[model samples]
Target: MKFFAGAAVLLLLFALAPFASVPAGHRGVMTTFGNPSDQVLSEGIHFRVPLAQKLNLVNVSIQKGEGEGDAASRDLQTVHTRIALNYHVKPEGAVSVFRDLGNEPGERIIIPAVQEAVKAVTARFTAEELIAKRTDVRDQIIAQLRERLARHAIVVDEFSIVNFNFSKSFNDAIEAKTTAEQLKLKAERDLQRIEVEAKQRVAQARAEAESLAIQRQQVTPELIRLREMENQRMAIDKWDGKLPNVAGGAVPFINVK
Candidate 1:
């Protein structure tokens, strides 16, 4: 009678156990006798065998991660880069994620993947190209990260390069090169302006010389004789229609030849 009563009380306790509730944005993984089952339980109240099964909740929401590391560019220049990423566990792969990475997957997996991806992509580009082709570099890194993380059932949603740092020498070289280019451009423009001004001056001198030549070509013996006759007529008109008082023969003093 004692054994029967104890067994009945145990049965009632197990039957009256509370149902497991998986929270929002989480999926439930059931483990039977310390071994996880392939079946995933959706978010809601679930029933499991008492003492034989346990329910573990895995979050599937997006998460942000940041990492920084140093690498070498293709040109052998040292580069330090900080990167950020947005990712989430694959909903269907929750079982695999739980079995493989457990909790704190970001530190265990995502950060290392980011570091590796950054190094791999940076090596393919020179320091200058890294600055110029930033979009391409980011895309390549994203691709590599996706390929690497997918095996672990981690999905990468987005990736970005937060910043890139280079050696002081490289930065100084870039600045000097930019200044030299600006100076060269200014010099070329000045030379062009000077050439244009010189040509304008030459054209003005040529025009004046041509005008003088044309005037010389128009001067002939007929024109010279016409000028002398015009001057004699002018002297006759200015006379008071009377000869000078002391003239010996009262002759007209006009050169009309």
Candidate 2:
């Protein structure tokens, strides 16, 4: 009789084994006889058949992944880039995602999506444009990735380009081009300064010449004779009565009436 009682107890435990708890931020997929059911289980306690049904939890929270890959620019230069992606499996599509992509959707979907998106976007811009227009390139990549992954029920929260690398020869070429441009600008500024100085000198010479011409036009012989007579009259007024000195065979002030 005790043996039968123990067997009954074992059967009861087996029946209770299917009761399970789904944690927060997770959804459970129930598979019966190795076939996934369309109905999904939300967080909290649930019950299922012990041997015939299996429950797998799928995290519906946001997850992050990183990847690096090489691509070619429009200028045929090799560009290497690192990318960071934030994504999540749609809560409503958790069961479908799990059924289609299995447990790890990021590996099969997100990583390759990131790589292809980056390559496609990078190929549209030259190396210099890629550096200058980083935001545009990143936006293009994110948009493409979002569109592609949406079909698989993956939601892309955010995407970013972490780093970009070029070959040593390409870097050296860019540096050389920048240096040449700077030198050309400096030369242009110097030429402008020299031209301004030259113009200033020519203007100063023309002004001095005009001043001398104005003086020549105003002076006359009649004005010079009037100035000499005024000086003699002033001398005569200041002299005393005695004046008998003669020089150079002529008497001074002989015509003084």
Candidate 3:
């Protein structure tokens, strides 16, 4: 009984030895003698010798994460940006990334590549141009990032500028200059309007003087005779039992009624 009981205990202990459980979407890289070996474990229950051999859990699932902004312009301007990263372990290149950059992909590979690319692109643009042509800057960064990180199996989904800030003095100066230019334009328009009005007034005065001179020159004997005939006909029709006499002194006001 003792022998069988001892065997049973040993067997039970052996059965519960250290083993790695690799769920779905995961792979276990088996290592022997602290070095990567030829064997790989698929998704399921896996056992490794308690000490000699070990299993490293590697996620084979498509994963995604974001990196928030950090950087400064050459002229000491703050640049805030964010990048959304989409990446799947190169079901094949997993070993390569692991061999090269260890397990943490973002910290080791993606971040450095991004930082280098962003710095390289941003250095080419001035602070003002960066704020205005932000989309352009972002595109160049994305292109460079993809090209540089392609070897590491990291794919960038999108990148954007979150915030762009400039110095207060510079901003205020730009606004002030814009306002001054607008004021100058308005003054020029007003001056033109006043000059137009003056020219129109001079034209009106000239027209009136010319009209009077023509009338004065036309006052001849024939015109005076015609005027007298019209006045006499009007007087005959409008006579209200009174006679009007015009002397050389002054013509008195007549009451037509």
Candidate 4:
């Protein structure tokens, strides 16, 4: 009796094994005889066949991933790109996603989509444009990734370019080009300043020459004689009613005869 009761309880528990509990934020995939079924179980308690059916939980929540890739730009420059993305599998498509890509969809689906999208987008822009138009680049990448991964039932919530790296040679070349441009601009500004200064000096010299010419024109013989006559008249007006007598010097108004 004891052996039979023990067997009966064991069998009862085994029969009740179909009563399964799917955790929150997850959906259960039912597989019959090692083959996946189209039926999906939502979170909470569920039922399944004890011996022939198994329930596998698939997380339908948002997931984050990051990857790095290398691509060539339109200018033939090698670009190293690092990307971060947020994604989630559609609840409705969880079965298909699991059936197709298995549990970890990030490695197989999201990563490849990211790499291919980055390569495709980066090839459309030059190195300088890629750096200058980072927003546009990021948008294009996200668009491409969304479109590509949507086919696999993986929705891309957000995508970002974490970093862009270039070869040391390319960076050095860019620096040199920038320095050369700055030097050229400085040289042009200096040339403009020198030209302005030269024009000012020419104007000053011309003004001085014109002034000297005016002074020369004012110093004529007639003008000199007029000035002397004015001085003599002024001296006569100031003379007193007396004459100076000198023994050796000649008299002013009377001759010695």
Candidate 5:
């Protein structure tokens, strides 16, 4: 009787072996003898053939992948770029993703796609434009990645360029060019100020010369006679009505003429 009870328990265990649990944020792909099916199992207890069937869980939640590569710019400058991508498997396409790309889609598809997309986009811009028009470059790369990844049923939620590295010589050249432009601007301002001051000095000198010329023109013989009469009156006003007591008696002049 005990042996029969153990056998009954074994049969019950075998009966429950086909039912599998799929966790949240994941989908189950049913495969028959190593072949995937189009039917995607939603997150719950699922039923499959006991020995001939398998359940493959594909996480449909957002995942992050990173990639880096050295590429050449449009101007032939070498660029080392690193990027991050947030993506997920399409819930409806879990079967195809598992069948075609297997379990590691990030390694098989996402990283390679990122590298290729970055190379394709970077080739359209120079190294300087990569820094100046960084937004455009990043958008183009994201668009390219979305297009490339959609075919594999990998949806791109977000993409970003983490860092861009260039040659030391390029950086130095940029710095030197900036310094030279600043110095040139300063010299231009200084020249403008000097020219303005020189113009003011020339104008002042011309004004003083014009005033002197006008005063000389106003001086005539009548003006000179008037000045002499004025001086004689000033001398008489100061006299005490007495002549000098010298050997030669000198009298003060009273220009009556």
Candidate 6:
């Protein structure tokens, strides 16, 4: 009876050995005799042969990592770049990544692979192009990295440049140039306003001179005689405590004192 009890206990222990739980967004790769199997285990409780088979849990959820890149400007100046990357394993390719790349390959392969791809692609573009045409450059990096790392089951999710640094002197020079251009534009506007005002003044002066010339042309002998009589009347009104002896000609004058 004791021998039968011992045999039953051994069977129970063997049955309970090496069962694994795969969490949400996780997959399991089973390796036997140091060879990864083609079959894949998904989330939830899983059982594997205790000694020969091993379960390696991989998070199949979308994940992200960040790295740095460096390059030169169009003028051959240095630039430093910070990059953020998103990644996920292909459902069908998870086991292959496990076999070729080691378990938990976050920094060991994914980060380096992304960094390499970034540098490779960024080298083709200057720092200014990387900044101005950032979207295109980022897309190129994503494409190249995805192609290269997919063989290792590290799929490129999305990648972008977080920040970049250029030479301080270059930035300052650009700002100065922009300021000078603005000043030049303002000066041109001021010159244009001055020119317009001067033209208006000249036009006004010419208009007044033309009005005086028209008055002169309309004058005849009748108008001149009438003006002379009006001037004599005004001179008589201005006389005060003064007398003038007039030689009588066509018009007779009487002296009153």
TM-score of each candidate structure, all chains considered together: 0.78, 0.79, 0.63, 0.73, 0.76, 0.73
Off by over 4 Å in 5: 1-17, 202-257
Q: Please tell me which predicted candidate would have the highest TM-score against the true structure.
A: 2
Local accuracy of candidate 2 as per-residue lDDT tens digits, 166-257: 99999999999999999999999999999999999999999999999998898899988998999999998987978777667766656656
| Candidates arranged by lDDT, highest first | 2, 5, 1, 4, 6, 3
Steric clash pairs (candidate 5):
none
- Select the stronger candidate by lDDT from 2 and 3: 2
- Per-candidate total of colliding backbone pairs: 0, 0, 0, 0, 0, 0
lDDT of every model, 2 decimals: 0.90, 0.90, 0.74, 0.89, 0.90, 0.79
Model 5 per-residue lDDT at 228: 99
Runs off by more than 4 Å, candidate 1: 1-17, 224-257
Q: Candidate 4, residues 28-70: lDDT per residue as tens digits?
A: 8999898998887889887788888888988888988888989
- Those runs of model 2 whose alpha carbons end farther than 4 Å from true positions after fitting are 1-16, 222-257
Q: Candidate 3 — worst ten consecutive residues by lDDT sum?
A: 88-97
| TM-score, structure 4 vs. true | 0.73
Candidate 1, residue 183: Cα displacement in angstroms equals 1.2
lDDT of 5 at 179: 100
Error of 2 at 129 (Å): 2.0
Off by over 4 Å in 3: 1-28, 37-55, 59-88, 181-228, 243-257
Report the C-alpha lDDT of model 3 over 24-107, residue by residue, as the tens digit.
Answer: 876677777678754556778876777777777666676776666556676666555566656656555555566667867778
